[model samples]
Target: MKLQYWGTAAAEGLPAIFCRCETCQKARERGGKNIRTRPNAMIDGVLKIDFNADTYQQSMKYGVDLTDLKYLLVTHTHSDHFYPNDINMRRQGFANYCGNKTMLTVYGSDKVMASILPMAEAKSMAGLLQGVLVQPMEKVQIDKYTVYPVRGVHAAAAGPLVYAITDGEKTLLYCHDSGPLPDEVFAYWKENGLRFDYVSMDCTSGCSPMDYDAHMNLERNIAMRDRLLAEGLADGKTVFCCNHFSHNGAHSLYDEFVEIAAKEGFITSYDGMEVEI
Candidate 1:
């Protein structure tokens, strides 16, 4: 599996769209890793984790061919993660320039559908978006992969979902657009003998010491990472990646953030970063 981190910032992004804070300004001065867009990623170039406002820009920057994206697994209905209206760009008259077939299979919660349905209805996009309402513990089959929607602690605007994707060999746990993994999800992990080879955690906490009601800080992420290690859900073979940052965190510099997380055995993610499994 090839995991690509197209954008690693939280909703506002680094050098936030309209932010005037020192953190944003500092990022503006020091480019490169300091630059980040909304959180989004791709798996093996075939599956996408989430869609944000910067999806198109990220795709272009990373040279990603969206036409090959077969499955789109959404974690929530957050604007930074799920941009329903932008999905219409795949319609026949819109992006028909791609020579290959471009049907996208979408999986998410009911709230996700609510966001997509209106946009899909607005356009004549028929087969462009094949959406399936997913629930916790449901195993959805997409080609050679099996996807699981794990529960997480987060705001209930429309309810949130995290994903566990596997190809019968390796598993990747994408935990973001979420806070901590709920007790039920851990129980399911134990009950099903589930293990992850790759774990992309939410580090929105940045350098913060406390956890959010719907997000994780560095301390909470470390605790969660350690717990997963002890529970056998993660082992020496696991690739623990930390991403999805907010400017509110202690450090705005990517190198500084990576250094901090590295002390606790985490590889900080950056835009256009790709990890092979």
Candidate 2:
């Protein structure tokens, strides 16, 4: 499986919209990996995770055509992660798709489905969108992939979800938009005999200290990784990646943050990073 990170920044993005922080300034000055958009990922060009406001820009920058996208998994209804309005763009008036399958199936929690269903049922977008309300821990089969939705500890209203995907050969744990997961989550992994090949975690706070449980810092990231390793959910061969950064985070610049993360054995994701598992 080839996993591509389309965007790796938090809600505000790197070089935030209207800020003069040192981190944002440096990101603007050094505009390569530092210039991150909102967080999102695509697997093998068919399955996508998180459709945020930056989707359009990320698509153009990465030279990806999303008209044929088959599946979309939304983590939450946060505007930065789930931009429902953009789903309309795939309708008849906006896009001219040549594929036989015109409908794109989206999976998310009840709240996410609620936010998207009404708009998708509108006359303009009726036949182009399909919203499936998936409960936490529900594993669903989508063509060649098995997607397991895990509940996240963020946004009560949003009911955020983390996804574990496997093509029956390699497994990827795409965990984000939440802090450290509950013990039962890990227990479930052990029960299923699940071992991940690639693990992408939340690093919204970067190297800073956070008092909340909605997001993770670098320290929390390592702790979580260590726990996963000790529990046999991840091993030395697993590729651990830290993503979803914020400009306000300590050592927020890509180069600076990566140096810190690398020392502790983690890959700091950039806007257009790709990994093969």
Best by lDDT: 2
lDDT against true structure, model 2: 0.88
Give me the displacement of residue 72 in model 2, in angstroms. 0.5
lDDT of each: 0.82, 0.88
- Flag clash pairs in model 2: none
Per-residue lDDT of model 2, residues 234-269, tens digit only: 999998999999888899799898899999999889
Candidate 1: TM-score? 0.93
- The local lDDT score (0 to 100) that residue 84 gets in candidate 2 is 80
Candidate 1 lDDT tens digits, 106-156: 888888887666655545466566787888888788788788877667778
Worst 10 residues of 2 by lDDT: 93-102
TM-score per candidate, chains pooled: 0.93, 0.96
